[model samples]
Target: MTRHETFARPTIADKDFVLATDLDGTFLGGTEESRRKFYSWIEESRDRVGLIFVTGRDPGHVRDLTRRRGVPRPDYVVGDVGTTIAEVDDEHFLAPIAPLEAEIAAAWNDAGMRVQAALRSVPGLTLQSSGFRFRVSYDMDPDRFDDRAFDIVAELGLDALVSADRYFDVLPKGVSKGPSLLRLLTHLGVDNRKVLVAGDTLNDLSMLTMGLPAVAVGNSEPALISALEGMEHVHRAREEGVGGIAEAILHHKLLQ
Candidate 1:
């Protein structure tokens, strides 16, 4: 049985405010004090605040973050660079929604091996050992990296994404954080106006530009900032990490 099947609570759709944020350099990015304050605030406002971690990280990492490290667990997760859509039950365990992942799986078509084989000769790319279900990720060295890797992925009919100049990912054609989040919101009857999307890298570009209110934290990569030019709905926060999230929350008046 699904972990959340027996648990009962007001779904995020019922909450007045919901935060769909990226980790690493957004929700978990800020200073210790800032993260503490932000986490404490969410713990205090449990009834009003709905949290979702939208990240490139996989489910196992999400589980460890909350269960072991005490980061406030999210009600839902749009994880694996949007390749995974799942609910985090009251017990803080993730349950993938099969229906939601149907398309992602189809697009992936068990291409991890093929992708690896094709890119094995590329320099400066070290495959990550996460054993991702729908994507293949690599630790990248920018100086020696081949830009043609992008072309290789395209030729395979998949999408290629690089973030923070440190990580590279090959995903299903057209799958990424933004579209997956939209699917989750729609399935849950969430009010888009009440949602605030947050991120600090290029992979986040898809979601930030998806018309939802968004924040590009102060420490965001130049590539991401450059892409957001003239996009008024996105707030450029002065605070780094979780601090930036708090700034955006106030800037958007989400909690007020």
Candidate 2:
């Protein structure tokens, strides 16, 4: 099956609304050919879609790419794993959210106090001061970091998500792509049911949970495809990188 065959477009015309997606490995490709496809998707869908970027990257990097390349700026951006929301106008401006680093730090230290702490924990698994913190398992066997790190974060009450190949991001308990996307939906007065989200990692899972409709690109982990398997509304694109993203949108008839 080709990438476009992954998701069947609904016959019913839904509201014209949101297209929220991730950046790395979704829109922008790691190589030149894929990058062009990313740009093509924007050009093809710009007028019909309310383009929003929900990414783990900082808002500045998002803006920098837009400014440097002259690509269409996202209407709304949920960045730093939902720690910052930006409303882009003539310029990209940031709206800050509550910082959760201190709380995560406190939790780690308290876990250390327990007599039977399951694993060796980092003192303050602080990735940066950028609202949320990412903690990697220090005791992880070199070959098993992904599974181990995921296990650690799963124990937390906060919104913990894994991404790329090596890290897990910790967000405020309620903040995630779904909630962040809905916030943009509310701002635009668009119906949530019309939204379509696409991505390739664990961080993308929340938006899928929104139960609107979601597309997991071909490069996405096998576990994700299995999780979404029985859901008719959830689709998996066949192409990798940006080409896959276009297939997802077109296959879902999001551009129309």
Q: Candidate 2, clashing residue pairs?
A: none
User: lDDT (CA) for every model shown?
Assistant: 0.94, 0.61
Give the range of the ten consecutive residues with the poorest summed lDDT in model 1.
1-10
* Clash pairs (backbone) in predicted model 1: 30-241, 30-242
TM agreement with the true structure for every prediction: 0.95, 0.69
Q: For model 1, what is the error of residue 232's alpha carbon versus the real structure, in angstroms, after optimal superposition? A: 0.1
| Model 2 local distance difference test score | 0.61
Candidate 1 residue spans exceeding 4 A from truth:
1-8
lDDT, candidate 1, at 5? 78
Per-residue alpha-carbon lDDT of model 2 for 1-256, expressed as tens digits? 8766776532112337566778777766435777775677566765555777888788768888788875568777877665556667656555443232343344444332221253335332324443333232222232444445445555654445655545555555566676766665665566766677877777777777677767787788776676677877777888876667667767777555
The runs of at least 3 residues in candidate 2 whose Cα sits more than 4 Å from the true structure, single-residue gaps closed, are 1-17, 37-41, 69-71, 95-120, 123-157
lDDT of model 1 at position 93: 88
User: Model 1: per-residue lDDT, tens digit, 84-143?
Assistant: 999998788899999999999999999999999999999999999889999999999999
- Minimum summed lDDT over a 10-residue window in model 2 is located at 133-142
